[model samples]
Target: MPIEILMPALSPTMEEGTLAKWLVKEGDTVQSGDLLAEIETDKATMEFEAVDEGVIGKITVAEGTEGVKVNDVIAILLADGETADDIGGADAKPAPASSNAAPAEPSEATEPAAGYGRSGSAAQEDKPAAPAAGSKNGERIFASPLARRIAADKGLDLANITGSGPRGRIVKADVENVTAQPATAKAEAAAPAAKADAPKGSAMATGPSTDVILKTYEGRPFEEVKLDGMRKTVAARLTEAKQTVPHFYLRRDIQLDALMKFRSQLNTQLEARGVKLSVNDFIIKACALALQQVPEANAVWANDRTLRFEKSDVAVAVAIEGGLFTPVLKDAEMKSLSALSSEMKDLASRARDRKLAPHEYQGGSFAISNLGMFGIDNFDAIINPPHSAILAVGAGVKKPIVGKDGELSVGMVMSVTLSVDHRVIDGALGANLLAAIKDNLENPMTMLA
Candidate 1:
């Protein structure tokens, strides 16, 4: 039997996905571990792998087709020589499977996404730049057959005529309403009588050459290519996350002077053992240990329950070319510092290049969005959903602190803010969690222990 390849839900918040690219196309033979396609989930344009060995029969979903719901069939894997039409029924509909889903009613939490039922349009502002002159036709504009007939009957060239369809394909109404005069006017079109009344330089003034002039000494023109799939996904998701997550800021400055000294001594001693410790790695270990101490804050906001995850899947937010992605360091509480650092290095490198598989980028019990390297003083982060809170780390700065002897001493202090989902955790609970993390960071020995 042919297997239906459903769009795998990458994140819990991912209700639908856009088919970014197909690593394997129709008639291609794929092994069980082969890459099948790249899916643009809410968070990342992650590589989806094949789970079953078979010949790729039909591609139910085309790349760039967005708003395809979860579990919706995007492709088919069949036995040798089977065609796609033979597997998935010929009656199958396209992206945004036909459903009785009504327009979503606005509520306090949902009003932000009004008119977008599950079947609503995928964010199109995130689409790649419009094709360069003479590029291949992207999603053909949607037009009714009647409209096509009307355009044909009217001798209206669809090419010159602009489309008013969903993706900008010419429709019947568009053909009827265009300002182009009839071909009969071609005789009188450029006649002197017509030219006398025409506004001087009107067409030239509104012409398209003026946007950005790029001409070479040799007379070659230049056109800049656009943001790739990874970049577009990064922009849309991060923007939506920051805007909709209802963020409230919290900042705590910590004395990291002792912590830094300890790390310096620690990295030197372990240098020969191939375990070099950075202060941030130590901070991650500290955060992991602290999470174990206060598991309540590690819960996700569910319908009626604050869902507490049992594992310590620590999502370390890493930055890449166009945006940021957080590939989780799973079971951080169980891994040694070296193990954690090694795993993080491998994942971070791949994530930055958009080379990570869906599994590597998915699932986290908690999150850490660190901007310490960029020298950001402090910032609040959105809770990458299904994970209740995210810890934002700022740069460590030298500041005066009261010594045990009541004398002023210079110390290194790093600021951190934990952005918690109000529905999942309370403010006091988040504060306690931050205090525990601070303690672990202050006592470097405990993080190692």
Candidate 2:
């Protein structure tokens, strides 16, 4: 029998991605573990591998095609004993499977559209069977199994609900929206034509449209830069964070002379090992320790409840070309300053190249965004969820300060701003967490303890 090759979901949250390049063309002989294609998601570009050994019978989607939906048939594979004429069977169409199918892998023919790793036999045994095929007036409906269940329970017609998911496939969200409305209203709400008219992010509704903004620059000789997937995602997420998350900012200036001296001494001692420390490294250490010392504030907003973390997983924002990567250092509190520095250097390098995996750049209860190296004197940062707070670090500058004996002295002062999600952290708890961070950074030696 001929096999169908569906577009694989590279990450958990991915809906659609660009079929960046085809490593194998039609009629190419492919083996298990062979490189199949490269897929570019919003976060990174990942190479896809074939799980099946077969002759590539047909290539449906061409290279550089954007918004290729998951489970959409990308290619056709001819199994052994199967000729090219046999490839046109009904089996070539992708059968809708369970939403939680195992990650697809490269393999020999059978159960063709399953996730990345399982063989044909394992896929059939492990995967939940697709919904029984039936539809109104003999017209088949392309809706997820979960969506069908939800529509049944809500007494909503699948024909009325519209799908915003890949390839106009109805999903749970589309069905849920129809639960409270009449069939006519649901049809209106799900109309793709209506959605196409509205601009995203309330940008058009709240302010002037991009067309109006561009009108002002007309004949001014400006380059019209197109927004890449990363830039578009960043803009939407930041806008959502600011609008949805109730942010409260707390500013503090810490004396850095002691830390500066301590870092200088440590750097000299570690110079032979080729491990140079930066102020940002110290800041990361301080935040990690602070999360432990003030465990009450080490939490994240999980939409329904607060999630308190046991490990101080710290996400440090690394700026890339078009966007930024917040690569997490898992269990950061247990790691030494040297370890953090080394790991951070590697992460930043990979992040710049967009080689980081989804897990590497995701998850953390707290984040540290330091713009000090960029000469930014101190700016408030957006709370990157599900993180409860982010610490924004500024550059150190020499300033006069009052001494212990009531005398004036010159000291290096660095400013920091703590942006907290008011939903999870109150003002008092946030202040205490910031205070602990300040103490650790000021004393410098205590962080080692």
Candidate 3:
């Protein structure tokens, strides 16, 4: 039978994606792998593939459409022996009995939806078959409760084991997680078998619902905006994360005089190359390097287990229209200052323009949020799920310090607060990571080395 193509979630932070364009028109013959449509999620425009072999019987969603949910049917497919009338009888993901089922994808369509971070790595031979549970028989659970429902409606089972949520229960952690998994893709090929072996609520699917508060722009008496697509998703997930997780904060002050001096010297030569580096970029690299020394802090708290990562993908939070986003700087320790600065500019600029692609803002091992540019002294951050910790950075200030000889000295002061999930990250582990970051920042040269 002809299968339906969906409005794919292109990024993890996405709730609903815009039906940016349709690559094929109605009644067009399409193969299983053909490009069917392009979806605009919060991060970027992504191409959707035909999930099943079929003749395009009808297109339900038109191009330039907004707020299309991921799994709702976008088109009707015809089978080899079936005519257009038979398309309605073909077995669908849920049931084919409902003729009134909406032809368009689901309606969580907010602005743009983002997919989770994903890898093409092979699923562990030991951990296959998780997908079966998310089918008609079992339900899906992920790093967070929302990711769970999103995965379920999209027909993804947390059992297949490629996880983007904190413990990888297949939350809205990766856009690829929304796609038909690979035969050998971490969760796709083995989902059936994995479903039997999968544990219940392994993704920590249970959490308290969050409360949302409305706010207005600067200097306005009051501004309350309506919650739609991405805004609503952010409110819901962050609320659940805060209400359930036992979050604790650890604040530290680092001397940035050395780092500032270093930047001055670097910028002199860098200016000739048309590149300018910021303190935030240095912080990004420093945090990435610190993760190597403190992997325990770089883990997710999954159902009584801690999942640690080897490389640090730092999510740099950026402000966008009507909301905020964290566009990841993958593998920060591996990139040069110029490269990091250049990419940050690109991502931030695109975020402002609402043009980032899915891969840009998917899940990261850790995240850093800076408000120093706005002259904010300091603040604590909320824990982005699955990530054990988040670093909140504040403005650097001019301060005085006592030198070794007891003479007055000028130094640059910066404050950072690490928001930790006590379940996964211990106080000592978070301290160690924070100290490591301070050492790198105060020294400033070690990060480059």
Best candidate, lDDT: 2
- The Cα RMSD of model 3 versus the native structure comes to 12.2
lDDT of 1 by residue, 1-449 (tens): 46667676665445567898999888899988898988886556777888778887778788999877665557767766565545534224334524886533222121111111111112211111112111113222333334444554565444455656544544445766765548775345336334534432332223354444343223666556665545555555555556555555567998887788888887888899888877768777877887789988767765557678776788888887667778888788899888888888888888876667667877776789888889999997877766777889999998888988999988889989988777777788878888988998888777766
Pitting candidate 2 against candidate 3, the one with the higher lDDT is: 2
Candidate whose TM-score is highest: 2
Ranking of predictions according to TM-score: 2, 3, 1
lDDT of each: 0.66, 0.79, 0.68
Candidates' RMSD to native:
16.0, 9.0, 12.2
Deviation (Å) of 211 in candidate 3: 15
Of the two candidates 1 and 2, the one with more favorable TM-score, higher being better, is: 2
Error of model 3, residue 221, in angstroms: 12
How far out, in Å, is residue 62 in model 3?
3.4
C-alpha TM-score for every candidate? 0.58, 0.79, 0.65
